[model samples]
Every structure is written in structure tokens, then in C-alpha cells.
Target chain A: MIGEFSPGLILILGALLVPLLRGRLRAIYMLALPVAAFAHLTTLPHGDLGIIELSGVSLTTLRVDKLSLLFSYVFLVAALICVIYSLHLRDTVQHVAALIYAGSAMGAIFAGDLVTLFIYWEAIAIASVFLIWASRTEDSYRSGMRYLIIQVGSGVLLLAGVLIHYRQTGSLAFGALGLDTPGGLLIFLAFGIKSAFPVLHAWLPDAYPRGTPTGTVFLSAFTTKVAIYALARSFAGTDILIPIGTVMAAFPIFYAVIENDLRRVLAYSLNNQLGFMVVGIGLGTDLALNGAVAHAFADILFKGLLFMSMGAVLFRVGTIKGSELGGLYKSMPWTTGFCIVGAASISAFPLFSGFVTKSMIMTAAMEEGYFWIWIVLLFASAGVFHHAGIKIPYFAFFAHDSGKRCQEAPLNMLVAMAVAAALCIGIGSFPDFFYTLLPFETGYRPYTLDHVVAQVQLLFLSALAFTLLMRTGIYPPELRSVNIDAEWFYRRAGRSLADGARMAAENGWKSVTHGIGRTISVVIAYVQRHHGPEGLLARPWPAGTMALWTTLMLGACLILFYL
Target chain B: MSAHRDPKEKRYWLDDPANVTRLVRVFYVVCAALIAIDVFVPKHGPFAIEHWFGFYGFFGFLACVALVLIAKQLRKVLMRPEDYYDR
Candidate 1:
């Protein structure tokens, strides 16, 4: 059975068998499966794997290329790290869900045909919600439901788009489709939601932090990356993504700066990172594509690492609020350092993973003659230093001692953090390792004196700004409470509107009933005057009177119809 | 634990169990080990992973240290009343 299946399927199937084993064996299975899958994916030659004929449509179900390869590589790596992080977890459901979610995304990335991609795409949305629900909280449950609804809606739209695309072109090949068409626009919106493009982003901050610690790690890797994969595939070279991505890069930093929950702040940062990838795809050159693919790969790792550290804090201390945490370095110093590396990497500090990959996207923007966009990106980069780079670690770890000494995270969690931290510095120090995997020819060196010095200058300036703001008490303080986001449309405003409509309808019905009562009473009085009975109908029981009433009713109906 | 203390008596911030050095030492050891790993691992080739692994591993460790320290710092900023955000 394993021999007949592709290596990707084999890996997923092996993961499926993990829960059947107990204790240490499960951990081994979890760790080894992803490594094996990574080996297989890296080995595949770039070309069409095979074609499957479905309903007279020849669908390219598996295609291996530079673009898909980059994302699949990250997906596999994240699975391995999450497995290590959750090694202590014996929860079969969460374990199985994480694997299925990871594997399904891999399946989508390798899919050569639109139909096949759509199948795995929907699987991603469905399999992923379990991660959120695993938190076992009422708030998580409600948020999970909302997340599922939006994801499913995206899937439905994709399906509709696929059907229409097939009808219009009669081909199911997975490649770029124009946005000018109806079906094309539908697919774009579907990808947009998964990518967390602007207004469609509520599902991210709303549900991501609500997931189980381990579950959130997996969540960080798959959904947006897959959306990025889709956008890279379908909308590469789309002119609209340029401006859209520029706005995306700048808009979320404002929110991240204000967010109370550290994890939610990371979520906004995730959106900002995706903006980088969008710009790469928009540039649509070989260099740009490489930048996009490379950035996506780097992003999943660092972002997952960041989320994992936060998850550990949440797991141990029962809170991720910046306000509720501090002075824990005295008790959980490893976690504090791990958070610093993550912060530095995210801020694009020198010799970190982010320094190597993120620059490619910005350079691509500058090289592509989008200097104005590059300036915006520079501002966004500075903003990243402010929020993700400086704000997360400084406020959470070093800002003020909260005196909440939680134990160091468990051994498994430590190992996971260790593994992720190693990757961040390793990639930063040796850009060549990551550069070789780029889809474009990588003549661009990230560690040149000019680039490093410029980045350093940018970061220090932002740090200076952060310090000045904090000293002045103008920086938004992280406190325990829900902060509003785009979700307020559905969570608060939408509910309020619905309630108002319901009340109005209810009151309107009451008035109509009251009016009917008044009419009935008037008729009763007329009947009493005529026959001394309770109503006219009760008094007028004679056959001739009844016939006269029927004729009169028929005459009135005929007159109304003619009028 | 503090119920026996008279209301007139002044309290010290160091009195909390969270501020004790014993637990802090444990945190320090853990942080040191992670920093060691982050600083030295890639120079040793057997530990090297692909792009994503390297990226995640590096930041992830720093995040861990930051988490520990953030826990300490949070006490100063954290509000006692649950309705802190209400204002």
C-alpha cells in the first residue's frame, strides 16, 4: 500500500497510524514521518507527476515545481517541530488533526490540477478547525465556528469558480487565471480570505490564539501559506496585488501596535508578513517569485516558532496577555531567549532568518521600479521592528517585572523551541542555504555591507522610536481584555443589527394583532346593535341573510380585483 | 499567606514566591542552555536543517528566553482587577 501511494500520501498515512501506537513510539512516528516526507518532496524532479481523468476532464493531480516545493518544504518542517512541541500530548484527536491538516496542505501544494487542489484546499479548511476547538474553551468554540464558516465559504466559492472555469475553458490545469472574468474574481476572493487580505482577516486573530498551544503552531504554518501558494499560482503578475500588498504591509502594524494579546499581535504580524509575499507575487519576475517562495518558507518557520513560544507561555501560565506576564525570565529564561530570537528575526535583525529572506522581497520591489512601494515597505519594515521586533520581547520579557514565575516549559516544548531557534540563526548566518531553494536565479546577496548596515540603521531607529514612545507613555499598553478588530462587524455590529431587526418585526406583529383586535371589537359592536348577540355573524343565522352576505362578499372581491 | 500581616505593615514586592531566587536559577539554567544551542549549533553540521527549520529554530529559542523574562516583567504592568481593559 505504501509503495503504490506517493511519498506525500505515505507520510500522511504513516502519521495516521501514530495514534494507534502508545507513548514513545508515537513520538518517533510523528517526528520521522515529516522528515521522510521532506526527503521525498526534495527529491522529486520538477515536472508533471501524472494525470488523472475525472469526468472526462484530465486533471493534473500532482506537479512538482520550484514554487510548490518551497512551501511544501516549510509545511513539512513545521509538522516536525510541532510534533516535538506536542510530544507530551497524548490527545489522539489533536495529534491526528495536526497531521491531517499538515498533510492536506502538502497535498494541495503538490496538486497539479485545479480540481485536485480544490479538494485538498477544502480539506485544509475542514481539518484545521479542530485545532482551534482543541482549546476546549467556550470562546474558542464560538470563534472556531466562525472560522469554519468563513473557510467553508471560501471553499464553496472556489468550487463554484472551478466549475465555471471548467465550463468556460474545459480545462482543469492549475495555472494563472485572469482576474477580469467572473470565475476568476471568485477564485481571487477565495484565496484572499485564506491569505488574510485586509477585511477578510478577522478569522485569524479571532481564532488562532484560541487554539491549543501545539495546535496554534500547526495553524501558523498551513492556512496563510497555502493561500500564498494559491495566490502565487493563480494571481502572479496581477497588477492589483501590488497596491493591495502595499496597503496590507502598512495597515496591520497599526493594529499590532495596539493589540493587547501577544498572540493576536503576532497574528497581525502574520498578516504583515503575507503582505511581503503578495508583493513578490505581484512583481511576477523570476527574482520576485524566488523572493515570494523564499519568504513564505522562512515566514512559516519563524512565525511558527514565535507562536510556539507564546503558546508555551499560554500553556504554563494560563495567559498570553502582555499585561498579565513579566519577570518570568527568572523562572523561564529559555523561553525568554527564544522569544528574543523570534523577535529579532521578525524585526529582520542582522544574521537572523528574516534578515535573509525578507530583504529579497523588498529588493524585488525596488528592482522592479516600484520605488514608492519600496518606501512603504521600508516604513512597514521599521514598523515591524517596532511591534514584532521590539514590542513583543521588551514588553513581555524586559519591560517591567510582573513577578509571575512560571516553571520553564516542559522538556518537549523546550526541544521544539531549541530546534526552531537553531533554524532562525542558522539561516541568518548562512543565506546560501535558503537562497539555493529560491525559484529564481539568486544573484542577490543578502549579507552585503550596504544591506546589513541599512537594515541595522532602520531597526535601531525604530527601537529608538519605541523607547521614546514608551517613556512618554504613549505606546498602547497590553492589558487583559478584548480589543476590537474587523470581526466587530460580525461579533458586535452584525449581532446588534440582527437584534434590532428582530425587535422591530416583533413590535410590528404586535401592532398588527392589536389593530385586528380593534377591528373585531368594532364589528362586534355593529353585530350587537343589529341582533343583541356577541357578533354580527352569530346574530345573522337565517338562510336568506347568509346568502345575502355571501353575495355581498363576492361583489366586494370582484370590485377589488377590477380596481 | 499574608492574612496574618497587619494592615499597617508595609509590604515588599520581593515577598512574592514568584520573585524567589531558587526558581529563578532554574530559569537561568534553561535560558543558558538554549542560548548555547542557538549560538553554536549551525557551526556543527549534523544539526543543520533546511531553510524553514533553521529559521524557526533560531527565533523560537530567543522567543523562549523572552517569554521567561516577559513573565517577570508582566507583574509590574498587569492589573489585579479583571476589568483592566474596560477603561
Candidate 2:
């Protein structure tokens, strides 16, 4: 069944042929592939597919486990919506790349071993860059290049780690290789880079917002989620990840709060959301792991929805920046409504998808007595509501109505948002379907009275905080400026270094040429003074005179040596 | 290029009575109601409906209103120079 004519691969592979057709037929063909893929995805049996051994080495692969299954299912759903959202786009490169990108991510989820996962992992990196480049602008082009470098660099690290890990343990499985050695740390770094852990996160805000509308949606779903999956598999229950994850959760909120580019803010929030999953993985309990996996599933759905709506706005009016957007609700109510659902879900409002999954991690934290970590995570949760949950929808849909009207996004965009919106609500309302796919046996229920009550209390107070801040004019409003992030290092420091090197090289060459010119001039001057017709030595030093002088000098040297 | 425009269009949300008053009233009613219910209501299921209404529904409504009003306010700030992302 794993290798059978599954639609996930088929739709992505079939999309490769979309460009060969012309006009409306091309659009229809591109659209048909994902629908077919979604159908294939939904039909797959919800249990492990057998692992394959390569070269007599067991890869320890499993397929259709609850965690992997949840992500795979959400990937298909998000992909279908993205396809519709991007139906009007004519870029064949982006179309093919997006399908391949989404399909390969699903491929990674279904992969049975570290090797298969690694293959798809690199495939995602290689295929996804074209979407960034599809924007076809100089900045986008440059950002895409940087994006490619970081992503491919991450793959190289993974491959190296995999080789070392294979040599160390003689197994190529994808689970619980704790940070016991250099190779393990290397593997963690590999996942860390993709997961956008702190300083490694430059590529996200740099690249995602730079992609074409449809392209950003595809960017939002696969890359970080794949890293989350890898981390869950490899480092779950590792205590070190708890603090790393906590920092990951908290730091991005400040950036998101201050960020002017609404899409980029979402990108930061993506890092924040990944932090929640990492914390869960760090907790490493069955319930906690379930939360991480479950959160990955919900994150993809709602985050994709947020990106889709923003993409729609960009598709129509051509801007998603808060400074450039507002009053869209008047013109595009359905899109606005869908975006709110997405926002609420991400904010962890009661009866939202986040409400169901996020509590798992927090409960795990408290149970494990990581009291400080729990408090920090709770703070991060409030920050999430402020930046992503409230800020994204508020600015794009209804914030001071920009009054500039464009046509609403096409039918496909609406359908995409609606589908994602439906999943966000469905998962929140009925988490059993989602929980049943978790890898660990879960005795915990997300909808218990205590869980619901506390989550409500948390989110409600957070909302209250937002209102107070807004009233006091203290909340950071989106502006029309670039906020500095780690990319500042490359953009400012890297550029200055290049400039400095060029200047030094220029000066060094100039000094060398000047010195050589002076030496040649000095030699010419000496020769002119000594060998000119008027000079005695130049005029009279014939063979006879030169020989006499040499004999006199030799006699004088002998006398001086004797003395 | 007409310099003479309605003063209301130039006013910020905090400066505008109509906007700020409406927002402040809504914020007070919602926040007070939710906090009151959260403090008073027994924390349990079924009655969890009250908690949801107090917290989720009330704030959710506030978010919607804030979004709408902020949308109104953002109208002044929105600029549409072609291909803003390109630069």
C-alpha cells in the first residue's frame, strides 16, 4: 500500500505535467491533481505501514501512526486549499514546485526510516526554493538564494549526522537518539535550523513574505512542520529541549509584536508555534508527545488558513502589510470571517483547535514539575494571542479600513480558506479524531472541564490584557518599516564585511602599484644622475678606467684586511 | 490634491470621541462581564458553557468589534503604492 498508486505522490507528480497544457486546461489540470491527492490521502488506512530494511540495515520506519497520520492528513487538506487559493497563478515553476514541495512533505511523514525521511527532507528544501524565486523580483531573488542556502545547508547537516549516527549505533532509525555525542548534537542542529530555533530563524521572515501569494501558503505548511516531526522522532524526552523550546516559544513573541510586515509577523509566530511543539517533545511523555504531534497538525491547519487569507489579500490588492491593509472586511466578508476562525484557533480560544492541543504540553509541563518552564510557556501563550491570534486578523481584515477596494479573491482562494477554516473548527470541536492518531497512549482528554475552564481563563485574561494595552495606546501597531531581526546580521553586518574587504583589497592594490611605480622611478632617477653625459662616472668609465678602479679597490681591501 | 478635508478623517482612534467612546464602552462591558463570571461561576463542566460564554464568547465578540473598528481606523493608514513587497 505504501508504494501503491497513492494520490499524494500522484497529484504532485501529475502536477509536473500541468505546464504542458495551455490556458484554462492548465489551471484545471493543476487543480485536479491536489483534489486527487486529497482523495488518496483521506482514503489511506490509519495504521502503520511496514518498515523496509535497506542493505540489511533496519531503518526502523513506521507509517500511518497517529502523529504522522495527523500531519499527513492536514498537509493534504492544506495543499488542496493552497491549490485553490493559487488557481489564478500562471507560474508553472511555482505550480510544479508547490505540488512537489507539499507532496514530498507528505512523503516525509509517511517515510519508514531515517533514510527515506532524509531523502524527502532534502527534496523539500530543493523543491521549495523555486517558489520563493517565483516572485521574480530582485529582493525576492536574493531572499530566495539565502533561503536556499540555509535550507540545503540544513540538509547537509542532517546527512552528515545520519552517516555518523549510522556508524555510531549501527542503526538508521529516526527515534530517540539523545544528545549523547557530537553526531547527536549535529542532528539536533539540523532539526533546529529548520525549526527556526532562535538565531537560525532568519530564513523564515526573509523568505516566506517574499514569495508569491500562493507560494507563501505552500511555504507556511511544510518546512517548519517537517522539522517539528523530525525533532519529535529524534529528541523527544530529552530535557535539554525543554529550555530550548521555552526560549523558542517566548522570544519570537516580542519580535512579532513589533514587526511591521504582517506576513513576517506570522512567520515569527510560526517559530513561536513550533516552540510549543518542541516543549511538548522535550516533556517527552506520551501525552506531551501527543500534544506536540497534535499541535503540529493544528498549527499547519490554522497557520495555513492565516497565510491563505493573507495570500488572498495579496492576490487581490497586492499587499499584506498592516500599514497597507485595512477595511477589507467591508469588501471581503467571507474571507475576513474565515481569517477570524483561523486566528481564534491559533490563539487557543476555547472550542478552537489550539485549545485542544496546546493544553497537552502545558499539562505535561506542570505534571513534570517544570514550574518555571510552565510559567514562561503561559507567558508565551499570552504573547501568542497578542501577536498572531489577535494581531494578524485585526490588521489585515478590519483594522482602520484602508478603504481601497479590490475584487475579492477568486473562488479557489475562498474554497481554500473555507476548507482550512472548517478543519480548524472540526479539530477543536472533535479532537478524538485527531487524538486517536497520536503515537503515545493518551489517557488525557483535551475537553475535560478543568482543561476547558483553565484555557478559557488564560485566553480570556490575555484578551483582557490586549484590550487594556490597546486602550492605553501601548500595544505595538503595525508600521511601514522593517524591524531588525537576525537577518540584520547578514543584511547589515554581512554587507559591511563585504564592503570592508573590497575596500581593503582596493587599498592594498593601490599601495602595491604605487610602491612599484616609486621604485621604478627611483631607479630611473639614479640611472639618469649617474649615467647622464654630464656625469663623470657615466662619461669616463670605459674598459681601461673600470679595470684600474677594480685593481685599486682590490689592493685597498687586502691592506684593510691586514690592518 | 485638495487640502481641505473632513477633520474626522484626520483624527486617530484615540482622539476620536465616536470611535474611542464606542470602543471603551464595549471593552468595559465585555471585560467586566467575563472577569466577573470567571471569578463567580463554579469551575465545572456543562456550566462550562457559562465559562465559555464569559470568556470565549465575550472576548471573541470584543475581538470582532475591535477588528471592525480598527479596520475603520486603518483606512487612513492604508497605502497602495504598486508592488510594495518588491522594494
Each prediction's fraction of true contacts recovered = 0.02, 0.03
lDDT of 1 by residue, A361-412 (tens): 8877766778678867777787777778777776666666675657889999
- In Å, residue A263's CA in model 2 sits off its true spot by 0.4
Give the distance in Å from residue A495's predicted Cα in candidate 1 to where it truly belongs.
Answer: 1.0
- Would you estimate the TM-scores of all the predictions? 0.79, 0.81
What tens digits encode model 1's per-residue C-alpha lDDT throughout B1-87? 345545664444545657545545564454444333433333311112212223333333333233323433544453244433122
Candidate 2 error regions (>4 Å): A1-8, A35-64, A506-563, B1-24, B39-87
Clashes of each: 65, 17
Worst 10 residues of 2 chain A by lDDT: A1-10
